[model samples]
Target chain A: MSKSILFGKTLAELNEICKQIGLPGFAGKQIAQWLYQKEVYSIAEMTNLSLKSRELLAQKYEVGLEAPIKVQVSADGTKKYLFQAKAGNFIETAMMPDNDRKTVCVSSQVGCKMGCLFCMTARQGFQSNLTAGEILNQYRSISEWAEITNLVYMGMGEPFDNIDEVLKSLEILTSDWGYALSPKRITVSTIGIIPGMKTFLEKSNCHLAVSMHTPFEEERKKLMPIEQVYSLEEVIEHIRAFDFGLQRRVSFEYIMFKGVNDTPRHVKELIRLLNGLRCRINLIRFHPIPDSPLQGSDDETIMEFKDTLNRKGIITTLRASRGQDIYAACGLLSTKELVKKQEKDY
Target chain B: MQSLNPVLITDSQPIANKAFLLQFNRTFIFKPGQIIGITTQKEIAPRLYSICSTPNDATVSILYTIKEDGVLTPQLSALKAGETIWITQPQGKFLFDGKPSWWIATGTGIAPFYSMFQSGQKPLKLIHGGRTQNDLYFHQEFQALTDYIKCCSQDSGNGIYAGRLTKYIDEQESLPPHINYYLCGSAEMVVDVRNLLIKKGAEYHQIITEIYF
Candidate 1:
């Protein structure tokens, strides 16, 4: 049998591993430093540990990290990297360089189960959830790892759906013994699974972004099926109830579709729905997919909608479209062609 | 945000191969298509199941199939009468609007539609898909409907269409444009069926889906 991975283990879990392996309790911190701080690729590379201890550790565990197998670079300097997941499934991560800040978007699952009508990832169907190791490898294995200043959980699948691993990844990213990243530099996006969202808010301090494409309940039900299970009303109410101090941020992602959700009524409803919440609205231009009935709102309509929202006291910004040629933009990240079919229960 | 309430199992019985119907006394009011959250223990996360019994029934019913590796269903399948379980108030927006519509489902996705049908909301057409004829859980109850269609992909039987549900839909000349389409199934089935319906001339807004995540 293959050994379990140690890269994603928390400090307490590593301590337990030390006890099971008959190593000194402090060896757990040493292993954590080797796996996370130094970010070693092989167990043999931990030169500080005694050879006997290293050999015993290697017998049952590995510092699991897989490098990206494929990278697609756009003319505009956006790069999309494909990594083979531990289960042999594929996931995509995109690195965008904007002026001084470099943002790396990471995926939480192989594909997605959310089945949003406009998402390319949903078209692939859900294959499997990525372990915390797989989720962090996207950041640690990329070429721009040293320079990355921002991380967004906006790549392929819904982060909240895989909340346990997503939270683990967040902890490893923010904990002192791990990546030591500021929680403010990271943002996790979701289509509003209420239970997962509430848990995330209560446990982690990272920023939250909700995919609220339309404010109308009926129209949102058609675009995103999660509305049927956890309504947008409930999601907003949960957010309203939470106390997100001054530094932590909350934002709404609205993908503008022509004549469908860019109408004036949607603008008014958005204002009413988000009246008191201290959050920003990101207006994303929809990128058309194969056989999709929706179209992106024209530039004029997008600007007018942004102006209307801004005039209504909501901080709305039009996100600059990036990596369209390489399919790394919003709603366009998918590994469908590379996905191998798996046996589904239903 | 409703808390889970403890309820005792009234009955549990196998309805088909690997599928079971579980019953408990109804305590909370729910629309036919809404779902209830159930858990064997308070510490474990609850799984949402559509109420498969009618509103007027004295007991609430949940239809489920045993997934060997699933956390809840195997335990739920092994429960005996008088055992205790936790359930939350019914919730969700997959309710039938009492309109002319088509109900499409596969496997245990048939639960919500069964709830609506038992509640006396007859759909214009019901397209149910399964791997074998025996996979159809409530066929006898639906057989009397004039527009009921069954698509069995693996095994053929009398009066059954011998292909996948998407294939059956793809072969259609055009789908009805005015009627609503309610799809409850796995992500693959819902996405495939929704795309096919759109390609066959149905409006995207006319389709509402509830996928098992």
Candidate 2:
């Protein structure tokens, strides 16, 4: 049986898997091609491998894409799919359809670790990183399969902390023999993880968007706990090293809060902090969730804030809020549905 | 879990060593810069990719770059035309509003602003930057949008400005006052340009930036 090396298996792990299956040593790359490139659903589809090799693979490992157990459609075209994972825990993925494109939002972890004060997924805490297959299935199990045009890793967790698995999934998504998307189409957002940011910059050609809701370091910590460990200052410092000067883009996600981070002082400070960096600020209207300490800024305030940034010469715009009525907007997603199912099981 | 029907790969190709352009027919409307989800015929679903082409285009277009040791790209490469795949609808806030203006971008960051130029909304100037001449995608299309299409090549020798876009704009003795700077590309470039334009006394209301990375 080929051992299940779907997690963070380095090249050495692949070599051992190949040796046990009695294939030539170089076949490890071929295995990688299948796992990361071809992204086949089963060993049967590994036609390039010998029958004996395929048999050995089938004995131990199973390709990871699992189907969602249930699907819920929002009034708007957003559809959320729920799936039960290896340990019986569940996660959800969202599919949103617009005129020219189909966008699927996928989860990286069963739950999230970054306890941003307003996020429900963060309230669930971290479960575990998803296997490459499980992560891949979010794309595989949906309608209008042939019409998808873009991908954003903005669903459930902090992709950077789950770096290895996320990187592998990204490899499969962009590999020449795999999903083969131009890196520009795929954007992975993080709450400022230094190590992961560096790795992503060095490795992936895909775009990067940082979750920088507040330019002020101290105020930012109130909304996102990770601000303590990896300061926005450090995140910017690391990003500045790489030249996004060309096609590569760096954007800061600024969620506007009514009386909190949306003041003229706040906007001016945002301009001051980002004075030297070449980046854009996405002024996201704070999505209201139950018991959140913050309230969303009024449209007027958002516009004024955007005006200040634009006036100051930092390109800024208000991000349109979507899926709010369905608890599907930013920071509004909850696994309470799964929690209810678990209570039923009990 | 039910097995998904095969993904219909409408078209796929490697535009660069790690980037790809995957096209498919959309039964729905998609606005430019909206990120949509995709499920391959093999049953693997990845996150949303931003739409590059204008919604008016018949076929949907996605421009993506390869991730190092990433999984999605390899799978995307194996696809051929006519294979089944899953795509979500368009989603995002980065697009041209009714206000007419100039468009600026760095590298592949030019994708979102692609529609802005295609529409020919108003008098426009597209200033794009890349490390080399070949890195510039959609150059001719941008040139068609404005007579002042400035290409800033940082590494390769085929441009007037050898360094950054900010440097080139800084040297602009007389940019029109009403010109709205629609900037896209890397965060660093966006930040630098914003700071410089403001320092040079450009009004913040006249500048709009869509962060690419």
Candidate 3:
């Protein structure tokens, strides 16, 4: 039997994996406890299984928990962990410790295909989609696994682009037979790929965060190329139509670029665009990447913009600049130094 | 996903090795660069393909290369004429505006440009990259354009450029910085070409890319 990683399988999938090798179906839950809750590094650590069953499983499967090959600690207590993908490409994950909530940002793909102009990941292009195991390993393999309170899919690649594995990881994370964490603590962010968003909304109860840089179509088109495919208007309309019950939240992420998106006019347009929506806007400070055509808005400008939006009754919050010294702009360190460029198909 | 409707295949012509032009009866209109999702079974999620046929054509055509391990394309290529397939209504914002621009593509990424060409919207130049001559899906049709260059890394002669598309562009003195550079290809191709173009003086806004996931 070919070896398969037993890290990120949902309860049903775990059941299937167990039954395929002639184990009792209930062993799936026991395995899930060891794999997710206990965060064991080896299948042998699953001591509840019979010695014979352990040998049977060890013949085919292993608890594949890969730790970060490299780590850079920011002065602000943000640690950027680098893990190698299955294809030998490197993916970055950031673990940020704030007050009481320790949020670990996970990447869904090795590199990203969505070429947002300001993103360093775009320059590296796309490498591959991470398996459900790869996504969860960023959370489980880290030393802070037990203390982590929230997980956000907001790192290297667009979460919605690799939706299946992302949803599977979510299922394993929240299933009572699995990690049994609250879905509200996990948020999946995207550049608003509608089909994936629709599927995610229908299937999962995780909070949704949309990266809406600008309200105007042409302006956004210049900022994020995804605007050309799924227009923000269509995305907003879709979000409006979907009923995200009170507990489920949808927030817009606006990365402030100096002269491009921060202005009185943009603030007004954003207000008009997001009117009547039970959502808030999160203004993020853009960290400048090498040869970037964009620069982050000055703090004074960002503060003024946030004030204007908040004064107008649109709740807006500015995200603190974390891990700047560590090049935490997701993909900066990996693409610049670590990525082993694979042979191109073309 | 948009609601899929059953459509009958009218013709399934093998254009190149492992590649085919599948034509189905057209019921609704679509823009030249728009894409439609297609699947052999209604219950399965349809894979998206650019509409390769012009709007006025009675039948809608899509050019696809068969991926041996792909869930949809293998079954799709094996499908014959008179077989029914499920397809979504044409929806995509990669719309063509008949602007004078450079169209860069590789493999079956040339589908959208072919539709635009068939629709009478000519590009200033069409630069297509393919590993082999067989990889160029519609080089013969594109020959009608004022400027059509085939960058074939494997295939030679026949007036084709003797290298990859990125190399061909690199050999040039300078690519025009003002005109639009529309690229449709794999993510690697798009990123590499876009970076090269930017390095060669073309501004970011002058470039538009549609990358396949």
Cα deviation of B175, candidate 3, in Å: 3.2
Q: lDDT at A42 for candidate 1?
A: 88
Better of 1 and 2 by DockQ: 1
Question: How does residue A99 of candidate 2 score in lDDT?
Answer: 75
* Model 1 spans with C-alpha error above 4 angstroms: A86-88, A330-336, A343-346
DockQ values, each candidate = 0.66, 0.01, 0.53
Task: Using DockQ, rank the candidates from best to worst.
Answer: 1, 3, 2
Best by TM-score: 1
Candidate with the greatest DockQ versus the true structure: 1
Model 3 per-residue lDDT tens digits across residues A208-252:
999999999888876777786789999999999999999999999
Tens-place lDDT digits, model 2, residues A261-336: 8887887777777888888888888776655556888998888889878988999877655555567653244466
Under the 3 Å rule for N, CA and C atoms, how many clashes does model 1 have?
0
Off by over 4 Å in 3: A338-341
Give the count of colliding residue pairs in each prediction: 0, 108, 0
- The TM-score obtained by model 2 is 0.56
DockQ value for model 1: 0.66
TM-score of chain A of each: 0.96, 0.86, 0.97
- In order of appearance, the predictions have TM-scores of 0.97, 0.56, 0.96
- Please report the candidate that would top lDDT against the real structure: 1
